[model samples]
Target chain A: MSRLPSVRSLVAALAFGGLGFAIPAVAEEPALEIVGMGSFHVGGRLAEVSGQPPRDIVFTPGAPPARIDPNGLYAVEQMYAQWFKPRTERGRVPILLWHGGGLSGVTYETTPDGREGWVNWFLRRGWTVYNSDAVERGRSGWASPDVWPAPALHLPVGNPFERFRIGQGEGSYSHDPAKRRVLPGNQFPTEAYDQFPRQLSPRWTTTDQPTIAAYIALVDKVCPCVIVFHSQAGQFGFRVAQARPDKVMALVAVEPSSVGDPARVDVLKAVPTLMLYGDFIEQDPRWPTIRRTGIGFAERIRAAGGHADVVDLPAAGIRGNSHMIMMDRNSSEVAQVIQTWLQQKGLWR
Target chain B: MSRLPSVRSLVAALAFGGLGFAIPAVAEEPALEIVGMGSFHVGGRLAEVSGQPPRDIVFTPGAPPARIDPNGLYAVEQMYAQWFKPRTERGRVPILLWHGGGLSGVTYETTPDGREGWVNWFLRRGWTVYNSDAVERGRSGWASPDVWPAPALHLPVGNPFERFRIGQGEGSYSHDPAKRRVLPGNQFPTEAYDQFPRQLSPRWTTTDQPTIAAYIALVDKVCPCVIVFHSQAGQFGFRVAQARPDKVMALVAVEPSSVGDPARVDVLKAVPTLMLYGDFIEQDPRWPTIRRTGIGFAERIRAAGGHADVVDLPAAGIRGNSHMIMMDRNSSEVAQVIQTWLQQKGLWR
Candidate 1:
């Protein structure tokens, strides 16, 4: 029943005090790969023959086929660390945690002294977070994305500006985010003052939504899965749900800023949807409020054939949500709610 | 004395009938270069060389003594299309517009509308914007970040999950964010789920900060400049100022979210600073209210001999102040405040 190696075995296999990790071999975890899909320009051209076949495979949250790469080594703090160890037996469906704007998936979650992050929350919960940097925001590595032979890292670099400069700022954490990160390709000097297009567009957004669709397809393949959207990412999740209702087993929306009228979605299925919010909503302090819109939104989602309910929790006592929720002070409680909800449905925690 | 050609000339040069230009470059735009400095990995061994010598000589902002690609032709969107001819020629201080999270800086003025961005706002008032994407968020193209390249686009190719792909049938916008646009290096599927190391990091956030610093140094050697911060990119502007203060005349922080207490900076010298916030703020509702810490943050800067002020606008009526300040109802007022501040001080514009 246990396809995953013992935790002791993995710890024993890892190099603790060095800048790199050396693992003997874990028959439990296989390497992750994407067939012949190499460069975008060439990948587009090679699609006919390779069918985008992966040379090897690994495991990630919300990913399909449950491929695991036990040998994958990530460099953190100059020391190579194994960031993830996927369970080959598919212990449990992964949790897709979508963080809010200006934050990485690690977000507001940190150690008690405010130094640690949420890498462990899902790890202990028997759920894979598929956790990485918020694209260009975290320490998921991958600094130079345009280098030909291939980019070095493929994870978040953490907030490049103020955040990355801390001690042991290797990977994306060393780069600055603001001046350095903005527009994907617009990395030139402003003959006129302009902000972005630094370069590197993910396949999910912009004129193309392959990312959004691919995610839903993933959810469909990994049914009985739950997705947690934090802040601005809530809007993105809503957009996905609107596009494909059947793909989602349940949705845990935390302080979502945008929830399109679910009524507009005809295919919207009746899933166990939990829309949670903080009491400290932001707005004009007068005219329209978060509750008015949020409640209406919840009602709409519920009416649209989903078992939806808006749960307002006590404040985490932070300065602002900043569009982040999962990592808030009450994250434990939030986790419990999610677990309970999923368990209630016997969807497997 | 004109370093750049005019719109009419650009149109004639391109000879293309699209008033609104896309990626295709026009000869009129000083040979638009879409080159970018992505993650160090993507930049490969090329990044270190991009910041050649004397610290400021090779990699200054506007124009460097030595070009990273001296004789190379790079593709660019020709950022700041709305207001360059008037400002640069006038020798006005350029306004550096750092972007908010999840958005490229090009849309600084309005929320992806066809209007000028915040950078353009100052540009219209005789300032320049050195906007660059963080890394992989916008159209900025990137190469495979893997040690070995692979094709993942079979999923995102002809991405059909875009926001506008409504009623497109099953799997329309179903391309997975995790599997689709991801570069080749992502062997750890755990982090790849939900399509991560986000295009959010984009290139310029770090690799280009120095690139931009190089540009700014050149621009400053010729003309003084000011820094502007909006949302997530706030910390970035501060970092740039820290890297080079003499070049930056002042700073205008609009509804900034990062750059906590200002006492932590020694890299930047004291300068006139203004921190603006929208009355309509975004809140988690469940989190304790986080005041605009940048105000006191500015005070700390002032205490350290730097000048800083906190100015709160009347009901900004802006939705997602964390996201939309430059495009809010009070955007014109925001522009006016900046213009007035610039004009009153006789700082170039």
Candidate 2:
């Protein structure tokens, strides 16, 4: 897959709409082609104080794992994103996938349940997809307290379960197989609970301003696009759409836990918004309030002559879905549902 | 599949713990077997003035179609239920599946999306299941304005869509397919929108008392059972559990839009309650308030040392779920999740 062409060849290739390798026609090959696969950093500032001495660390571990240059300028907090463009792009706009709290672009790449995720789902449908590791997340540069003002917060073990409602109360953290209590009717792929923990990333409450700024920069780089946000990124999607209504063709909020100002909903008149919800929200103490706020924003958008669609899966005869709608066993089916909506919106062919 | 045995043969068959047909060893066959199948009516009184009501009328349409008696005791509001018992009942308690507003026991039959519904899901899990056509709906019985205090209420088109978050405003019922708009992330099988309208039954706002009485009567007939209620049936399930706490082994409330008095939550200390919700609930104008009330009741239950399990599928990482969780594309998966929970609760072996 990585048969690289020379810089000269690559520049020449970009002339044909960033076309990369022409995938050979084979019966088994998928119809779509990844014409462009590239990455870039957004919203990083030049280091004002450089020339700091690098500290040496243990090189290898028999007793020690490999480590090096522990004191270099390794943290920037600028976000990193990768874009995949299809050779036969049928979409009017590309999709920008933003992950939720304490997660990265990995959220769209593969689900916690090890299912083929939204990224592939979108691509197979002939839409260019950009997956971003937002500021201080995933491939994005990490924040050292020394450089970033505030230290990144570490997510405690069992917090995801507690906050996510996979289990009830402290019983979620119980080590005893007998003591562990999964909430009844949970749509989460509990068999793969072990895989979920590995996906958790450190998050900082104080980084909202910077992260939003970085996300807006990403929007600037790829605007007039569909922005799909999940969970914590819900607010970012709303704010970015507000900031660049013309650039954001559409916004899809998948079980967004929160969003921005409800009163200023008129700003999103040009950008159609779709709010997707999962199962078991009424049971959550906090989600209902946040969901109400988003609904308020949506109502205002409609009042202002904007198109906002709210799809409650359960009410529609689809059920037993969790917050990670993209990761559930029926993730692809859910993706197809979203894709159909997108098609109906005139975003995709 | 239907090999009826005589009463004498059935009595002799009871020697092996009510076992009926032995499951075939073929891998294609499901493990469970329907050992018992029967139907009965609950809560109806004989018409006191029947002698004056022997008038016969045409019951069939078309010029040459057949005709039959049109006047009979068809206005009785007694609830009707059919039970399917497994050969080897693994679950300690039988499950009583109740329908929702403007629907009948058919709600638990085939899903709106044409999938094998929850009736079979629970049965496959080795539980004796009772599917009930509630009073004033379906085969249970229809009440006339003459017999009942008020006429039945018909839910207007677009109300379900608007209240259920299935679409945007009145545009849901638009005749022009192009003009019709469905909520973007709606889990409701919009493809089955044509089918959904067919499932709507004539409902009565004033029949709550009689309906509740009939539901309670049904519970009395089938005591020590797990009652699974959806939407409108939620309140009935709660009241029944309250009236006969000992009879109800557990209660599963699936997106019950309205419930009982939150103040009297203490009375439900013995029976475990599981409240399930689907997506986009916050968007609904009424659901947020109702959900808060249910949450309040759940909190009281916990404080009272009762096992009140609130399963928010969204928070649990499953997403795009709808109020009709049992009818979702992943309905079986969801049923298994509930089955696992039941097992954990010691309701099933």
Candidate 3:
């Protein structure tokens, strides 16, 4: 793949618009060429429920009674995926982006701070992008409470504030900006911190089987492709790769919270993998243990004749990143790093 | 705007691919040019909650206690919008699509049966499309129960089957396809009927204020535009137009369940409106009342020197449509009718 130095310069120019008068306007750059774009749902099964009471309810406040027959066949646990095919291809395979828990494909679409997200960034670099909402999340429908009885877990505002490492530690977050204790050189834009939660969906603990099945089906449909998953999807990425090593060209796990079964590490022998973590992981309450799990998995993969690279952003000299590295201020630079890695691995055409 | 006959032919050729061996390959057509595409969140206020219990919980099954600090200024009620700008423009203004209750912007996207949806349909017709998820739905974050209080309403699988007019009557739907009583000449694809609920979301009763406020904000952001809203968003469409009559060039309400305030009907005097309804409204249990309300509002607008056209599809020679007309079997034909109406009204450039 030919590296476009001009695109990087154009991004730099747009970042510092007025200060750099010598730089050309952003409009002068050739528009990103998109050959095709569409979305589809994958996985899910028809489930039948019986012995439920038939109730008459109003859809609207004062509308006539509409009978809701609970005993019927319901389609449940399907995942949604939207794909954008670039006219100019660079990667040998498409890049499938899977989001973390309590989130959907929106995580890869646009940043909470209203900036271009990784999906667009990678697409601009000449890769077909497939952004998906996991089962029971976003456009992917949820099952009835009877089918999946557990209530969806919610992340309170302060939970991510401290857990994501945007704040220094527990109790570091506050309603007032002045009182909120942000890390000294945090890469996250705290001004738009509140906007982050807008992308979060209610997550369930019992839907992993359906989620994995859906993801496998997606891989079966469009594979020999790379997977770029984040946080909770880390385990999914690894497990999917193990399930179909011939299909998964490479794996990029961004701050993965969990790893796959160590027994299946040998299955990923041919899949080049990158376990990418961000700054403040060493100091965060739970990240240290989570990072170790990822590291342990990486070590296991390497022992099994697989290529696994554990990259701590701070050690790599890219600092101040929180758990949400993809949404960080230097997100594009980080994306470029991944792009370069793919090229080195000979995955980029 | 010039209507490209070849594009329509291309769609037809693809639809009947094997039957028409004489037609050119789909790749022969020029790719759809997208100059820009991005998304953003809008319209939410910081709501502070106090006197809630301080509980410790695990985000994951085995994770450590993440303190849930409930007393704080939490950002809620924000709506999310994603826009696609076609390289070539045909409409004098953009088209803003608003979805109904129990659904998000996904309703305007790909159909449950895996066909291109209205967003792409309009974009292909050269209109810049802006699809939005209303407040407390989809990518739009929801407020804490302490703030909004009321539980969200859910549509059981059978609710839409009969209510949307896919089934013949109240007890027409059954789990088994053979046993089900689908309406004769039903436009909905019953095989994919199960897929429709995938787009349904948990909608709250108490979020109308914030939802309206957010939609108004969206209108304020991209205006002098046409709004095509469906179902529950009908009230929002009319109310927003009333709030900014000059900005809303035209309004389309497809099977809108409710109308705007009767007192503010005069505010829509300058906005040309279309209250479009599908088949079975005359015989449906609740649709007659709902349709009357829409027709009544249109009459009020006309009496106030405004132009409002109420078109019933079956009367207009297009039959077998459900309330979800956008996803019906003849959805493209329905879109064409709307396009023709806009062209005749001088909304198209």
Candidate 4:
């Protein structure tokens, strides 16, 4: 493990064909010739600009403080499973808790209330929980100072949507967070938030914000785990699912209310999603708007042809429910339901 | 407009690629030659079960009405813009109001006194105004049904990630009003909310969603009027800048937050972006957070070698202006600043 491991590069080799992205810099060593390409440094001041740096390629294990190329394609970073405890006792199937709106990944695992956190929820059931914060939302950071060029709208387009640069965070939510509401079934928790730029904000097109790829790479190299997404984080997890479908064996999405077009259910079809919704009646003007969104979300997922088993909390014999049932008293029961669901679905062997 | 326009034959070319998606059934009439895509069918239920029925697209001029895709991308739907009567007779440019987290496009436009709505704020000041609830929110009825092939990973090395079946709605929010999110900057006017799913929900992979050429085509056909945004919509606008840099003439952002990662900012370099924010001193705790993210975003744009005019509301004498000040009493001042900024920047003619 003392040598540079094989690094994934978005080799933009358009062979009238396909290559993810090109590495600009290359450093050679004995065993694995680490090629560096598509790397750049971010400048501190808005006025000061930096030059494009080459991407450094190294073997996976041997490198210390492994500098995963911040702008690498989602595929490279997605190879590993995401969980809370990257390093832990052996056999801890890392359970990464994805947070909902207004909450970070950390909060997903252990909320202000010491109830069953997303991480603890899975942890007690013999699973390691890895709590991740999408860029800007949590402690995790973003990409280069400048926005990277998005892929052309062509076949095998690499990150064609330029999502890699649009890290999900404020600079996003220009609306007052206290006031802004998350549509329960909202596919993107803050897709439109970036428009409300504060006095000092980056232009989405021009800024190269880091993506989950960096985090995914960091997590994969650091620990072993299973991915668990709560509300908002499910979007990130969805992207992760696409980036590395293999790394995530089974996905447990606790009511990941989708805001994006459910019509594009293409991405959500494959990932084994377990959607849990509280007993919130639809068309209830009295209920929270998000609750309505959540109810609709459950129905939409099922319609998309995904195996969405939406059972009423009471009917399923699950207890302790609310908008955020993770911290509810019935959390343990919810956990058991999840275990049962996964087992029934063969997610948990 | 009544004639069916010929487009690139990618639709026909798809057959050679062996795509599982069913090409949209197009009816060709030498007389009516209408080539229109599917819009959000308000109050329609997603059909359950998979059956290839004899499909027919009913192209009613006002049949579906301007609605939003339920995926939560852009806040503004076709109806919002259509119903919104911009004071075009007045000197004000139209401001499209896009919703952020808790608020819908209407939230920005609605006030306690019910006077100075976000659209009204722009309209009263000689500007047109448009706002809408994102897909799945408010009244715009659009059910996004995702359809795709079974995603079995690791097929052809050169083949991109497994292509999901084309789900229908507005399209990708970023591209189509369906799967895209309205930018915060775009929120002010001439916009769609972010998370307007073109086809897929964010709970899926951004990469996995279908391409945005169609939506980009639409935006290229529209959005030249005036652009303003708040939080989440800002991200959408940013993507637009990249997608169609030529479409935007001038951009004004109020409390434009960061686009999660600072690294994503290359697209805004050319577009004249006037980034404004409220006074952090008198604002909420999220104020400075907004600034931090905003500055991070701007910093990335600058790092990408783009120029952005940063206007601090407090420093400019408009103190006590909160993040959503664009909809506040002092909004006109912000608008004036935008006008002045754009004029100085040579955007406003």
lDDT of 2 at A306: 82
Q: Write candidate 2's Cα lDDT for B77-109 as tens digits.
A: 566676666667788989999988766676776
Stronger candidate by TM-score (3 vs 4): 3
Put the candidates in lDDT order, highest first: 3, 2, 1, 4
TM-score of 4: 0.31
Pick the winner on DockQ between candidates 1 and 3. 3
Could you give candidate 2's per-residue lDDT for residues A33-77 as a string of tens digits? 444444555675422233444432221111121122223223244
Question: TM-scores, in order shown?
Answer: 0.33, 0.44, 0.88, 0.31
| All candidates: DockQ | 0.03, 0.01, 0.35, 0.01
* Residue-by-residue lDDT tens digits, candidate 1, A184-245: 21111222111212221222122113324444544454444467776545555776776666
Candidate order (TM-score):
3, 2, 1, 4
Model 3: per-residue lDDT, tens digit, B23-62? 1223432336666788877878877788878766555433
Off by over 4 Å in 2: A1-349, B1-32, B47-75
Which one wins on lDDT? 3
Native contact fraction per model: 0.05, 0.00, 0.39, 0.00
Model 3 residue A240 lDDT score: 84
Leading candidate by DockQ:
3
Residue A261 Cα positional deviation in candidate 1, in Å, after optimal superposition: 41
